[model samples]
Target: MARNIYITSIEGHAGKSTVALGLLYTLSREAKRVGVFRPVARTSNERDYVLEMLLAHDAVDLSYDKAVGVGYDDVHADPEAALSRIIERFKAVEAQCDVVVIVGSDYTDVGSPTELSFNARVAANLGAPVLLVLGGQSGAGVNRTPEDLVQVYTIAHQELDAAHAHLVGVIVNRSDPDHLPQIIEAVSATAGADTPVWAIPEDPFLIAPSLASLLDAVDGELLKGDSELLLREALGVVVAGMTMENVLTRLIEGSVVVVAGDRSDVLLATLMAHASETFPSLAGIILNGGFELVPQIERLIDGLDLSLPVIRTSFGTYDTARIITQTRGRLAADSPRKFDTALALFEQHVDSEVLLQRLDLNPPLVVTPLMFEYGLLDRARQQPQHIVLPEGGDDRILRASSTLLRRGVARLTILGDEGEVRGRAAELGLDISGATILSPFNEELRERFATEYVRLRAHKGMTMEHARDTVTDVSYFGTMMVHLGLADGMVSGAAHTTAHTIRPSFEIIKTKPEVSIVSSVFLMCLEDRVLVYGDCAVNPDPDAAQLADIAISSAATAAQFGIEQRIAMLSYSTGSSGSGADVDKVRAATALVVERRPDLAVDGPIQYDAAVDAAVGKSKMPDSEVAGRATVFIFPDLNTGNNTYKAVQRSAGAIAIGPVLQGLRKPINDLSRGALVQDIVNTVAITAIQAQGVAADSAAAASLAASTTTAAAAGEQS
Candidate 1:
């Protein structure tokens, strides 16, 4: 039952080590039996600390005959022997644990020596998921050339994928606070959002390992910092999980003495005695069974001068070692107060502010009402400010509301009836005593809606009863609330089409009067870059005028997000390379934009790469500002826009954000039919900001127009 998780790095010193340790430690806290394997090793000194910790903690379970340490010398001098030996050790360790953490070597590219590839092969052999680790260093975000990061990631991904390892996510460790925004943006732009990036903050505690601590804790050595041995962090060991023979070898050569707490004393003694030979500078021994220490074993350990730190836990040693292997330390950037330490740590490492901006707001822990129900919502409500429910008033939403309110996510609104709402809530496990419920049936508002309904109905010669009946549905009420500024926003469409959800808003709120067309834009965020893609959701076949409006709207959106506008009107053909209706559409759209907004920099009839890649743009249209370096792309139409955006999202491994509604009188946004809770929260926040900005701009523009009109009238009168 061991889940094999791989730990890799994009480049050297990105703190994959710390990430390995943290994940292992966290998993250990959850009581999962964990083991670890390293297919490659460079330094025996590093090996000593790593192995010693493994041995002392009973952190690993596999038994190996040969020593646990694999050296760079071994790799160069006897690579085949080293690889086979490491692989064998890994197989032994894997057998005894429920999960295995595969620690990656420093080789960032494909030409990984046999040792590294074998480690990946071992992960595949054990059928474990891979969690790639990347180190975080201050200024590394802007300092490291983009090419370097891309190359590193591309290689790491290639290796893991080639090994057929199921990469779960990435851990960006030692994340600096100030550079967080840039980093998150970069990673999102580079790696895509599907790959979760867990930013591990630097912990001073992990950095303060004394020489004595090193001797007693890990299986590593003084590389260059031997004089600062006391300052070293104990480098935990890697024990393979293939079989008993492999386990036995690790027991002997591994510096950290590890024995499954449940295993017989003879086995513990066996591993200890074996490890004592190669790793004479052994740190400590770990007992895995959560058992009381035997005095005789303790005396032997003390006499051996192998200072061991014994962690008493019920989890087996193999799993424990896997967890330990991932418990590397973090180093955050220097900060002198301004926030609570934990929050500061979160801000420094997680970069909450940058996360907020990159995510368009604070990330929400969201849950689905239909699937997870109260259980899911309860968990989500604990961390976020808003709770979004799917369109239905069921028992789950009400029950979850009590938890939501208690957790102070600020707002909890359901998607169903006022009449049956309380009953549904009561039917579920909801405590509605202190809950303030709002339903679609506000009598006063209902009456007011009836009046508006009658007028619209009168225009159509419909009766009062029919008019009242038509206005009673949740969609109508929800739409009215959004238009009337009663609620922040409403998400509908599980039982409705995009047109159905949007039609109600169009009827009530209408498009911005100045704007000829309302459109949608998709935000494409890759590793560290974000691109705005317009006409992706709306305007299936817009004319020149509509295209111009779409361009302006998209450019405005980019500006809102601090992206300098470089507009590219995309088509199937690049610069008339292919001529057809599609090419004509793009050409006309580009011309219309230039005519309407001469000041705006827009170019088109371009391919995807040409629009985004500088090299491609330079070759295709040397004189065009947007040809090779556009951040905002205006697709010819929704078919091409939607399809291309999705293709990029699926194929190129990009995160597609938004179908952010544009040219609306107010900010009314739409969510995906299968949107997560965080998606809802993020869309809402972005929409809110968009709405407020539009409102302010409208007021300013209107005032300016009025002033111009007055002056013109005065001149005419004179």
Candidate 2:
């Protein structure tokens, strides 16, 4: 991959952060060691919000001290010295990263029309490609025609050419969606087919300032309500002056309501509307006019459990409204909703993958957690399997579903009441319209599932009536969907126990013919590389055969994800160092793995340190190939495996992803009840990849059987 790229805008307020965020996320998927830098920037009083937002991503391992260089004033005072300093700082970041994203200055220093050229020169010096971003919102507002955008592109291209910077792509962000086709046609013809060109429509939600920005703009204080709601975006401003009936009717979703402090009628009505959910959900309430809350109003607001962000400003209603209208939105590290929306919009509009191909982002040198996670998503997306989420009631699931749908990662079927799921998603301002919402109560589906359940469990004395009721359980219904080919895989357990999520799989999906019992593994993502730990979530204490099976499956799982598997059977002893029943069990398991899969490289009766540490391995089992550098570790029991994985996860600061159930005839994985949205996304991606692997296995088996049949026919004819 091109290790460095510089993103610069043609003018101020060009939505460059939207373009930078998209490229950063795209680079994150392409490489694990991604870096973001700002060569020249305006140092804020508190912090750099854009750099902070980029650093907040897990894939970006950079500190503010390293990501930024001299200030705009410094660049203005001494251009040569400032460029040198910028190069020095950029090199420091580049030395540590495989690929870097260099975002241009914020253009906060007004009256300096040379800022764009300065940024281009910096990119040329750094040998980075330039991605020029144009402010389509300004153009669209002025009713600029398609030729206007093409003219903007021509000028930007000329500036970059003057600086000797390679132009890789062009993006017209904040453009009108209705005018995208004409703009793209004109720009693409000018940009040339070799250079990619895309247009991102202006999203009102993205451009709307957050409640935090509004509060700052009006110099306000929180009089009551949740402080967290300050992060919500204020899509519109409602200056309440009319009667309560008129004001309440005018209230809009995500709008900040500003009224005089004495307007208890409006306040009470807004509170009632918030409680009823029949009206629009507001961002918060802003009260001005310097009037203190009356005793009755204070008592009334205090009596309620309020969540609306209520702010008090010294300015009157009109002044507050004026200030709020002028406040533009910002992309801050704390605003996840904005980042999500920005990424979704960018992915929807930008052809970043094609641009990367032109830049030649080859495979990374080493496998990292970020790289592995991206691999799972990439594989799943290649085929786009239909994965089912059983826990539709969990907010995290729904949010992750929106992300998945937006990214086009997988086709999802959420098991729940259609109305309830739709209502919840709308209330949360989430767009999950792309997902398939299925309810367990659907009569036709329930009976078909119930009949299948009976066919699978008839020997267990399962009756039609009982099966019908049992299949109505979401977990069972979802698993049945996979079993009947309605879905490719299943991801659940955000609201249920591991057994509750996987029990239906055991009864219906069962294990592969070569496998006796199902097992699970945790892909421990360390800073540098990814390793596999097995039997950590399932099988409390597997005997020798089961342990061997876990080892074999864990290795295969690791290999399936592009991790090389040199097996290390962990124990309390290393070779002949000690003797005990536990060591002996591990030794026997090692022998079993060798007996079954001689193709695998394995070593057992080895201490944890020896299994991982090169020095310890040399001192203990110098002749063993798997004594050190083993990518997959098989734990003999759950007590040791679970505690060890958790300790490493917390102490070493690793990301533990899974309880990825293996050996299943079909793919079914479980999630921790405390799983975050990104965690759910990763798990679902893993489940989809596992589904791809299963299909491949079935296809291979069918091909082998057909060849055998043809050979038999040939022999009989002869």
Give one digit per residue, the lDDT tens place, for model 2 in 1-718: 3378889987887888888888887888778788989898675576767788888888888888899988977887899999999999889999988789888988786623378889999999999999888888662356346798888888888888899999988888888778999988999999888888888888887778988888898999988877766777888888899999999889887788998899999888887786565887777899998789999888998888766779999997778888999888887776666777888788778776787886788876666677677677767778888999988888899889987887778999998988778666654556688999998889999999999999999899999999999999999999999999999999999999999999999999999999987999999999778999998998999999899999999999998887889999999888877888898999999999999999999998888899888988988999999887888999989999999999999999989999899999999999999999989999999998898888888899999999999999999999
How many Å off is the CA of 228 in candidate 2?
2.9
TM-score of 2: 0.88
lDDT of each prediction vs. the true structure? 0.56, 0.86
Query: lDDT per residue, candidate 1, 1-718, as tens digits?
Result: 4445666654555555555544443333222345666655546344333333333323344433232536556766876687677767766776676556566665433434343455556456656666666555533333343344445556677777787766666555655534555655666677786665555554433443233343333343221111322322333453333344555555422234455654445435543543343322332345555665567765664555432333344556566675555454333212101011223233324422332232222222221121122222322333332223335553333433443343333354565554456444422223344444555566786776667656644757867677566556766666666555555445555445677667666766678776888888887765445778888887888987788889998998888755679898887788867898768877888888888789888888888888888898899888888887788988877788888899988887666767788887766667676665445544544554564575567679999999999999999999
Clashing pairs in 2: 1-361, 1-362
Which candidate comes out best when scored by TM-score? 2
**TM-score against native, each model:** 0.45, 0.88
The regions of model 2 sitting more than 4 angstroms off are 30-32, 43-46, 111-113, 139-144, 179-181, 223-225, 243-251, 259-279, 290-306, 357-362, 415-429, 436-455, 463-473, 573-581, 615-624, 695-718
* Model 1 local distance difference test score: 0.56
**Residue runs of model 1 more than 4 Å from their true location after superposition:** 1-436, 453-463, 576-579, 698-718
Per-model C-alpha RMSD: 21.1, 3.7
